[model samples]
Target: MAGMLNIGVSGLNAAQAQLNTTSHNITNAGTVGYHRQTVGQAARPPLFTGAGFFGQGTDVTSVTRSYNQFLENQVLQADNRRAQYGAYSAQIGQINNLLADSTTGLSPALANFFAGVQEVASNPTSVAARQSLISNGQALASRFQSLNTRLEEVRQGVEGGIVQTVESINTYAKAIAEMNQRIVVAQAGGAGAPANDLLDQRDQLLAELNKLVQITVVDETDSGKANGAVSVFIGSGQPLVLRGTVSQFQVIPSAADPQRGAISLTAPGGNTIEIAESLLSGGELGGLLEFRLVSLDAAQNELGLIALGITETFNAQHKLGVDLEGVLGKDFFKPIAPTVVPAVAGVSTSITDVSEVRAKDYRVLVSGGSVRLFAGDEELASLALAPAPAWPATLTGGGIAVSLPGAASIPADGLLIQPTRNAARNIAVGISDPREIAAGGPVSVTSPLTNQGTGKVANIDIRDIAGMDGSGDGVPDFSAFALGFDGTGPALTVPAGFTIERLKMDAATGEWVTDGSYPSGGSSTTYTPSADSSGVQFRVTGPGGYTFDFRFSGTPESGDAFSFGPSVAGVADNRNAVALGALQTTKVLGADASGRPTATFQSLYAQTVTTVGNKTREVQVNEAAQESLLDQATSARDSVSGVNLDEEAANLVRYQLAYQASARVMTVAQRLFDELISIGR
Candidate 1:
């Protein structure tokens, strides 16, 4: 009876443990990250008798939670990726809408500005038209500034997000470290038994941290046994949490670009390292970094490029015309210069060729007596400085000219060069008065009435007005000159400061053949007129960089003559305005490999809009796909580790029945004991 009672007591304890485990599971079924617990049991040692050993009742051994490491890791990875794509899509969508909107975009402003130019060209003397043009110019500049402001706001928002995300990551790391301590202590006190609840809490914290930034987890072992501690690493093995010690994360300005924010990690040993943006991938932080690097920067730079193109090209052409007062036209728009960071004393930068400018930032590195200029990671130009620093030395590359003064010393940390980054923000109209608009060409041409030939000067195109000012005066140095054609050929009586080149068309090939060149001081070129000689073309050049192309068509008699001179008080002439209006369709924005313009202003802006729209669409699709993947992965993980209410309820009934059976056995044992005692009495 004693042996039976002991066996019945052992069975009762085992059944009680199973019921407790089942109750615990049922109670915590709604808890996040909670795994169902199970009771482990083993039969006690059997008593050895003469015959076969009698079996002893069961003993409760251990309780463990159902968990799978592989499935959990898969869930984490999928969640991180989904978060990254979602963040990226949210940020880029704003830029897409901003650029693609017809009313708010640069395209409409550009078209309206050019339409105003056309108005001015049509009515050169109308003050209303000129004032409207000025208003349109101002509006265009304001549009550019406003667009840049919006982009800057987005950038600031990204910076704020980065700061918040880093703070959350650090907070999670500290909490995880504390949880590690609790789990280790609890497991140790439980005599090698796993602390299931504390382990779940730590895993929950890890999953939360992974949403902010992707991380890798490693189980910490003591003497080859898992001590319920883990080490967490992020951004290519940078330790974030090590057992009981937690590292910290900080947001700092980037070394390459101070305006941008970067992530830094501070180890427990007092070492801090800035993580490269490219190394950090997945999660919200990665998405922010990537969006800033690829989308935000590119959009701003491309907008600035368009602004620069408008300013440079328009100003160049405007300066070649005469205003209402017959004075030379000043700049139509203020020029934008390259921006250099860490302002070096006696160093200046300028844009020399707008066509060659690319939407990129540059770096100037000076080390070992050599100065190297880099556009991104590629070296553009390298020069060795002289033992004595050269004064007024110019380094030209990527359409920008960097000038260094004699006293200019190379900065040890190098300089950052941004050619067009600020152009959109700073662009403005240079002229305010409507009458200051240059609408008349500087030079005019006419045919002498005494000419007997049907030959007449059909067109005179200004090649370079700056080249025409040979007398060091601000005015173009054009003089009265006549080109008379005799029956044998055409002869030019050139002025003292003028040089001319003559060309004739070959009938067979239909190509112009250079006849001869006449130098200054009245030189003559002989060419016999032929029936197949289409016409005569003359390229006349004057001092002070002024040049023009003159084409003469039709047969010229012996005394046919044409003259050229500067236009005086030519307010009614709209030749320059016509030329300026042509800029709308001109391919003057981007250049090909051979340095030919490939895109008009409107076309380039359209391309920018298209690129942003495509990127936004791509990110949205990726986000949706990642969402699907995350759902699948979560389901897979939950299938193994998640609690099922129905299953837990069924377990409760089964464990309860076992407990009753054990109670009945114990009751029978007690009754038998009573019988024995009664017999003994």
Candidate 2:
């Protein structure tokens, strides 16, 4: 009877414990990260009987919380990737909006500016038309400045976000460290119960941290640590948390860019090592760094390319003509100068002219012997590193004059120099005067009085205009042609460096006629030609850089002579404007460092717009995928660990009934003992 009573008591105690656990689960059902608790039960040692061992009532063993390591880790990864793409999509959307807008976009401004060019070309002597063209040019420059300024604003916002994210990450790291300390304490002193609640909270904090930066975790329990602590590392195995200790990081400006962000972690020895941006991935921090390093930088330089190309091409053509005042046309637009960015700290750079700057970014690598240049991964040139008398010594290549200190050593990855990053910032009009417009070509072509033949020369126009080489040699190299036709052809003295090419025109597309003209259809008659007799195209090649083209269509007499000379000062010729307007459709943007044409300006800009739009859409799709993954992970975790109120309620009723039944058995045993005592009296 005593044994029976003891058995019932044991069962009652087990049932009471299970009931308490059920109540706890029910009350915390809405709590995040709360795992359902279960009271484990096992039958006590069987009582020895004559027949055989019989089972004793059950006793509670241990309370365990359900968990799955794999599911939780998956959730963390999903959150990380979702954050990265979300940030990237949000940031890149601004570029798409700016470039695709009809009003503020570059396309309309480019078209309007060219329209003004055509108007001036149609009426070169009209002051009103010239002034309108200058206004349009100014407007175009203003648009460039606005777009560049807005992009800088986005970069600044990214920097600010970095600061905030770093702080948040540090805060979470400290909280996690604190939780680890409590967990170590709760797990101390032999066969101790796990601090399941503390672990849950720590996991929650870890998920939050993953959103800011990707991290890898090492649970010491799996690695033979006594305290079962967790260690967290980020970005190429830099430890943020080691056991209970937390390390802080900082964001600093890069040597190559003052406003650029470089993440650095303070080591245990108090030294700081910079983390390469690429090594860090899978969160908002990764997204911001990637966008700034690649897309944003590229967009800004490309925008500058437009500014630099227009300024350089227009100014070069403008200088080749005479204005209404009969003076040589000076710069109608301010030139963009080269910019040198130092890869090493304390080094500097500069440029000489806009024409010297290309649209491509140059990577300057230093060696023991000399400095090397690279466009992306391709090496373009190298210059012997020399000592500087002037602060930044000049090394010219890749269409740029890069000024670097002769004494500075290049960093391992090299200096990234972008001469056009700020090209659009100060793109304002340099010429405001209507009379300053260069409407006439600098050279005149006319027939000499001595020509007795029926031979006639077509009107000559300048192509391939080069800036005055500061050699006082922009003068026309043409004199009266000693014209005549022997049985062979007409001959004249051709100077060196003078070029001849056929013209190619597309009237339907309105592209300017190219200088690649065809060979003359008619063969030379009784004349000695300077060029091939079969090819009636004769060109006076000059030793100077002066070049212009014309064609002859008639038979030349032996004594026929012609003269091509410098502008007879003050001719109201709109010939230069006509050629200048042809620049409206010129392919000037996509050029190699050697000045080879690739794509037109319109195509390049369109490509950029398409890239940003595509990137935005890609991020959106990726974010959605990541989000779906997160949902799946969360569901898997919840299936095993989440609290269920209905199950808990059922457990409550079952445990209540078990406690009552055990109490009733003890009462019955007491009643039997009382009856025996009464009968004995």
Candidate 3:
């Protein structure tokens, strides 16, 4: 009977314990970093029978947490990926907003300024319009200056975030290492288990670490400890946070520039770890850095490009035009300096006030139709004449040069008089009527040469010389291009195209196939306009220069033309030449106003305004989409692991009921034992 009672008591105790375990699991179900627990039971012992023994009672063996190591690892990995993109995307979205702001953006100011320029161009003599244009230009400059300052501020913010992240990672690593030490100690002491709570704490830390950087964990054994230690490292067993007595990882700032505040991890052997952000794939810090540096850098470069294109184009136009009467020697647009600048033309060095400097010091040169820029005394006409389809034929300068339609006398009355050093500066040559120029024959233009004695004959030529018909396949021909000569030199011989030597005649081919180099007496020949047919002749210019004479063996074909490129050493300026002819004096405002610069200026301004508006729209749409996606992903992740107060409350009540029942069972057992003892006495 006593044994039977003992068996019933054991069963009650085991049942009560199981109920407590279940309650605990339910209570912490809503808690972060909690695992479900279960109570395991087994038969205490078997009575020895002749053949076999039967179980007498049940005993609680162990309470194991219901956990899957592989599943937990999967969750951690996924968290790292999500965190990286989450942080980076959030930050970038903010920057996009800042840049896309209409009031603060540079687009509006630029549009306003260009519109003012159009107004001025429409009425060149209007001082009001000119002053307005200047004001608008100043506003545009201010916009660029402010935007650059803001970008620097954003860069500083990113650096601050990087430093904070590194510090956080170190803190977590130390906590994890401490937990490992405690676990080892407990296991060695023959404790029930290596403190499940402590293990959970360590796991929580690792989850946080994944957001900052990627990591891998391995089970390791300590020679003196009962339970093997856990070793933690980055990606490939590069021990970072060691699981000895204490955990430590090295974090250092970039050596190149401390101000940049970039951080990196180091190994015990003092080897620096190179972390490729893109390869990291799922680390918050890496993602943030990549977005801040790479993505932002690209955006800044693109902004600079647009700014550069506009600056170069506008400055080219400004270089050609005449400013206010007193500002003859000044450049309207400034040239930007080379430095860490936000936009093109942002750090330009232009003389805003010519009065601060002397006119002669300005030494400005406007482009003339006949003038060609040369690096040295060498002729580049042949290469210069070659067609470049991508090159815009319109002059960069906004100014348009206008000559009288016919060879008529230009009225001297009320002529704008200004002294300029620019080679392309407008000059009223000999007095001629604007309406008397004829279509045929050369018209005598009498513009006063800057230095007639110095051979500076600035004139406009509109002929085949301006077009790239010689070499380039269909480039627009400008008539105002010009070339300079020393007068004592050999007449120029411009080649249609350059020639490169290919294969030479081989020994097997006795015929003159491309093979052997020029023999001791071997000669090279070039073609020129023939006296007879347009066909070319390979003529030897010098005596004894020709080892043999040659000719085009095949008969003539339609559309075939004789072309020449290389020249004999004796032919001066033939080595390479630049054909300078006419300068196309088209206005920047519009194509219809081919010679009217004022109209062209208006057209350019309109294009800039349109482009800015379009960019604004694109940025807004992209940002909105990014926000929506982030919200949906967050909601889905939360449903799986989010803490809930109601669930915890329900678990608390259930555990209280089990505790009450266990106490009642113990009370009843005590009463029964007291009664039995009384009867025996």
Candidate 4:
């Protein structure tokens, strides 16, 4: 009878534990990260008897939550990727819209400005036309400044977002560390039993942290048993949490670019290590870093490139012309110079060739007595400081020339060179007066009607107007200079105040080679022509120090000649304005692999727009795909670990029935014990 009663009581206890677990699951069914718990049971040891061993009641061994490590990890990875793409898509869309909008974009402004130039070219003497040109130029500059301002705002927003994300990650790290401590204590007290609820909480915190930054989690164990603590690492194994201790994330200015922010990990020992942006491959923080590097910086630099092109090329051509006042043209737009960070003393950088400039920032590193120039990670040029780095030295690359003064020393930290990064922001119209516009060429070429030869002069390039001014006067010294090509050779006739250089085209390379030069009043007046020389090129310098280049094309009969002289003052000579207007179609932005000019100002801006639009579309598609994957992964994980209300209800009924049956057995045992006592009486 005693044995029967002990078995019944043990069965009742097991059923009650099952009912309790099922009720717990039913109550917490809506809880996030909650895994359904179950009571683990095993039959107690059987009693030994003469005939056979009798089965004993079940013993409740342990209660465990349903969980799958692999499924949960899948969900985490998918979620992290989705978050990264979503963030990227959001940020890049802004740039796409800003650059692609016709009204707000650089395209309309560029077209309008060029149209104004054409109008001025058509009526070179009209003050209204010139004033309109100035107004349009100012408007164009304003548009550039506006675009740059907006991009800067976006950059600042990204920096702020990064800072906020790091703070949130730190917060999650601290909470996870606290949960780890609690879980370890709880599990220890439970004597090897897992702290199921505390583990869920820690995982929830981890999921939140993963949204901010990509992370890797490792199970912390003691003697091959899980202690319910995890080690969390980010950005190439930098620890965020380690065995109940939390590390911190910090936002710091980048060493190379102070304008940007960088991530750092503060270990428990108080040592902080900077994390490379490339190492972070997923999550919102990763998205921000990537957007800044790949999209934002490139967009800004390209915009600045256009601004620089306008400033440099326009100013150069403008200086070659004569204004309404009959003086040489000055800079049409304010000059832009390269920006160097941690300014090296006596070192200055300038854009020497606008056509060769690329939209990239450079770094100058001084190591082992040598200065190396890098565009991103690619080393472009290196100069050894063998002669103590001579002053007035130049290191030229990427279309820019860096001028270093004598005795200049580069900082140990190096220099960050941004050639066009701030050009748009700093670009402005240089001249305010309409009369200051240079719309006339300083020198003119004329072919007399009497010449019978098919030869004609074309493509006059003004080298230096100041070079033609041989006298001490500001005005160019006009002269009667004539070049006649006879069947034997070419002869030059000038009034002793000119220098002439003769050049012939190379047959193989098609480049002109200088044959000879005649200084002022040189006795040599004739040159023999090569049989294969199709055309001849000459550079003429006048007495007032003005220089110009002209090309003679086609076959010339003997006595055929072209005359050179200064342009008439206060005349409607639209030659320079025509040249300036031609800049609208000039290919001056960058070069291709074949060394061909790749884009004009308008096309370059269009390319920028297209690139940003494509990136935005790609990120959107990726975000959608990752979202679907996240959903699938979550469903798979939830199917194994999530609670079911109907299942718990069914379990409730089954455990209730088992409990009633166990009670009935106990009642039967009690009655049998009473009957035995009755028989003894």
Candidate 5:
């Protein structure tokens, strides 16, 4: 009876303990950073007999919880990557919103301004139209300034985030180190199993750590004990954190020039060091860094590229024409400064005064009714156009020389230089029908070259426009033969007294055509027969040559004096705009009123507007796409690793049952012993 009672009691006790464990799990289901636990049971030693052994009641071996190291590691890594992209996408999206947004967006204001310009281009002499353009121009500049301020705010936020993350990492590391100390002591005290709670604490810390950076973990047992020491690291053998009695770690910041920031780690001296929680690979901090610092920064740079392109191209074109203000060619758009610093030695320190050599300093001279392009020196010329090249060129020669217009001789200090006749235009060359170049219009060389003697020289150099035989004059009349040449063949011939230079070509779309007569054919015109042939009549080439085909450029209304010649037009002219409808006086706003368009109110509403609205739309579309991609990636990551209530509830029930069973077993065993004693009496 006693033996039977004992066996039944043991069974009952085990069942009750299980119930308790499940209850505990349930109670803590909503706890943050909690893991489920269960009691692991095993049979007691069997009684040895001559024939066989009798089974003994079960006993708890060690309280074990469900865990998969490999799976958890996967979760950490994915989370890290997700965080990075999320951060980058979020910050960049904000910038996109500001720059290309629709409602209360800067883009609308910019478009309005451009529309005003179109109006001005159409009616250059109208004071009302000109004033409206001036108003719009001020508004556009204001948008830029506002956007810049907002970007600065974002940057400050990132910096603050970094500091906060660092502090959190330090706290986690200290806690881990303390846990290690306790764990080691428990093992040494002859504890049968590891300190489970402490282990749970450590594991939790490790998971948190992975949010910042990827890490590796190691488990080592005491010489004779099942419970062991834990060590964490970044890779194969790089110590991040170590635990002897407690955990100890270090925080190291990034040292690279581009990413000069700090990161935290555990156990600087340990064989297996681990990245801290704030610096780990799986959390929001990582995402923020990626989105705000890395990705957004890159996007901003691209925006600068587009802005700079428009500014430089327009300025170049504006330089070619004389504005009504009596100023030959004031820079229409200011040049964009390089957002990224160059890799040159002593660049930051040596170049202290940027204003002295800013783009505004370089002046263009349209003297003698001909274009004379010049640069101060070879170095300045290279610097001025550095933004022109997509990739950096290797410096084979120390510096290259440039050929400039109005050059009696090269400046003593090498201050005035021009693109060598052999130098190519850096722009991508376009080739199509000959009608692309307008009759008697200016043409631009498509390719640019810093160094000379490349095979890609423009067929018609602006400097040589005077010598083109447009009239088939035998003397090669230097003045009447203003012609334009694409680096490719089928150059356009400019007739004398014609202000229209080259025919306009689309940059994004490869389409070309001339603006005036000879839409597809031309009559033969003779200047002077070559001394060898008297009856020679110069017939212009057709289909493939001087035949005119109409192509649209920036539209101008009647009374607009703007005209491009075949010899001076190039891909850069695509950015030009003119006003046609409204007229007003020009008014320059003061610095304080730069960003406030409504302030210092000026009216020019009825002015004609011809804007480059098409281009702005492209920017808006790109920003939207990038934002959507980032959102999707972030959601997927959360699903994989984020905490779930249902799963936690299930674990809670399981652990509660185990705890109840353990207690029940103890109580029933006592009752069984009492029953045996009473029966024996």
Candidate 6:
């Protein structure tokens, strides 16, 4: 009877515990990160019987939380991927809109400015038209400046975003560390009951942390405290947390760029180490860094290329013309001195030629006293990095200049050098006066009417020569001389383009000027015409060796004369203006290191727009797909671990019935004991 009563009491206790667990599950069904609790039962030691062993009573064993490690890990990974793409897609969309918009973008400004150039070419003497050209040029410069400002604003915003993300990650890391401490204390004894709810809370914190920065989690149960816990790491095994001890991560303003924030880790000895930007990936911070480093940097550099190409090429052409002031045309566009910024981690770079600059950030890897350059994975150049000791090192041909300082300066992972990164913002108009516009070529050439021949001279240009000077008076020199090709007198066998035929000279100053007659006994010089000259050349030695050419097309008499004249001051000369307008079709934007032409300005700008648009489109599609995957992963995890209220409700009813049956059993045992007692009495 006593044994019967004890068995009934154990059954009652088990039923009561089951009811309590079911009630707890149903009440916390909607709780975030909650896992359902389950109770396990085992039969106590069975009493020995003659026939077979009979169970003494049912005893409750461990209560476990419904969880799956693989399913939970799947959820975490999916969340990280989705967050990274979503973040990147959100930020890159701004640049896409900026470059593609016709109203405020670079296309309209380029078109209107070129149109202004053509207008001036049509009416070279019109002050009103020149003024319009200046206005259009100013508008274009303003547009470049404005676009640069907007991009900087975007970068600053990204910097702020980075700081915020690091702070959140730090908060999560600390909280997780605290939870680890609590869990270790709760489960001190081996085989002690697990703090399931506390584990859920810690896991929830980890899920949130991974969204800001992707991390590698190590189960610390065997390592940290012999209790169930995890350690977290990020970016190539940089430890973030070690059980109850956490390493602090922080964002500090970059020394190279004050507007940017650098990520760092704080070691236990109060030492802060800088984290390389390349090591980070797979979360919101990763996405922002990608935008700042790659997308934003490339766009700014591409914009700079247009500004630079126009600056160098247009100014080169502009200098070939004469201004309305009867003087040489100065630079119409101010030069943006190539930025040679040194990295905080010990590397420096500068652009050697604006025409050859590409929209890419190059990496400078230094190792074994030699350096290698890479645009991503493609190796652009590699050379010995030993100190030049004489000249500035021209790395990777003459396109980029690099410097490696002392022995310990180079980082093991190298550095990134972005030369044209800030070009557009600093560009502005160099010449503001409309009268300074060069609209006329510096020299003129023609044929004399006395020459009864089809021979012709065309397109004479004054090429640059050191120490060359014009007359002190503001008026251009208009000396007239003739290319007298005496075909009968001397049957001179000479190079057709440059010949030592009978020479002539005529100048106000008779010192080495062309006068159509050689000195009495002086040695006559040769003539070297330009390449397009058909069969004749007229060369002069003075003024750094000026040369002109006549296309000796048909038969010439004994003395066929071609005439030369200096340009008139402030006249309607549109040769230079027309050349400037023709630059619209010139392949001046893209030039490789060896001076090979690639793309024009129009095509390069279009490529930039297309690249940004494609990246945005790709991210949008991938984000949508990742979101769907994340949702599916969450559902799968929830099915096994998540609590269901309906099931718990049915469990409550079943446990109550078991409890009633156990109470009846106890009552029957008491009645049997009472009957036995009565019979004994």
Measured by TM-score, the strongest candidate is: 1
RMSD of each: 3.5, 4.9, 19.1, 3.5, 16.4, 7.1
On lDDT, the candidate that comes out on top is 4
lDDT of 1 at 616: 93
Candidate number that wins on lDDT, 2 or 6: 6
Candidates arranged by lDDT, highest first? 4, 1, 6, 2, 3, 5
**Would you give me the overall lDDT of model 2?**
0.74
User: Mind giving the per-residue lDDT tens digits that candidate 5 earns over 126-223?
Assistant: 55665665566556555545555566677667756666765665566566667777777876684656565667678778767655545677776667
Angstrom error at residue 150, model 2? 0.8
Residue 476 lDDT in candidate 5: 21
Clashing pairs in 6: 504-515, 504-516, 504-517, 505-514, 505-515, 505-516, 505-517, 506-514, 506-515
For model 3 the TM-score comes to 0.54
lDDT of each: 0.82, 0.74, 0.43, 0.84, 0.41, 0.75
Question: For candidate 3, what's the RMSD?
Answer: 19.1
User: Which lDDT tens digits does candidate 4 get at residues 1-681?
Assistant: 888898899999999999999999999899988988999999989998998899788899999999999999899999999999888888899899998998999999999999999998999999999999999999999999999999999999999999999899989998998898898889889997988888888889999889888899999888898788899998888888898788888899888888789988888898998888999879999999999999999999999999999999889999888888877788999999889997767889888777777888888887677778877786767788896655667788778887766424666667889988999999999999998899998877788999886776776778777655556455566565776655654554444666667666666434455564532234124433443236557666666576777766665677777787777778897888998998898887786554456678988998899999999999999999999999999899879888888888899999999999999989999999999999999
Give the TM-score of each candidate. 0.92, 0.87, 0.54, 0.92, 0.52, 0.84
Query: How many clashing pairs per prediction, in order?
Result: 9, 18, 55, 14, 136, 9
Estimate, for each residue in 1-681, the C-alpha lDDT of model 1 and write its tens digit: 777777878877887888888888878878988887888998889989999899888888889888888888888988898899888898999899999998999988999999999998999889899999999999999999999999999988999999999999999999999999999999899997999899999999999989888899999999999998999998889899999898888998777677778898888889988899998889999999899989999999999999999999999888888888777788999888888886888889988889888888878887667677777776767678767555667778777888776423656657888987889998999999998899888888778888886776755767688655456555655566776676654455455666677666666444445664433223455434554246567677776657776676676778677777877764587878888898999888677677667788898889999999999989899888888988898788878877788887888788778878878888898998898899999
Tens digits of lDDT, candidate 3, 1-681: 455556666777776777676666666766677665667889888788888876577788877665567567666665666666666666666556656677876658756866665555455455565566556655665665565556556666677776787778778777777777887777667463656656666777777887787788777754654363576776444565666633334435533222345455565556666443344444767766776655454444334333333343444334222223211112233543222111222112222211111111111112232212121222111112233322222211212221211111112111111111111111111112211111111111222333122221112221211222224432212122111111222111212231211123334322234323322112222222122133322211222111111233222222222322111111111000011001111222222222322322223333434443444344345445544554555444444433344654565566456556545656676788888899999
Error of 3 at 614 (Å): 13
* lDDT by residue for model 6 (1-681), tens: 988999999999999999988988998898888888998899999998898987788999977899999999888888888888888898889989998999989999999999999999999999999999999988999998898888888877888899899999989999999998888878775365888889989989999999988899998756444477789999999999998888988898664444468899997668898888888898898888887877887888888878878877788788777888666677888876555334454345555665566666556676666677765566777766455333334466335666655434545556656556667887778887888899887676666678775556555544442223356554455354445554543231222233332333333222223435432212233222332235543333233344432224345555666655566678888888998998887776566555666777788889899999998999899889888988999899888988878888899999999999999999999999999999999
Model 5's alpha-carbon lDDT is 0.41
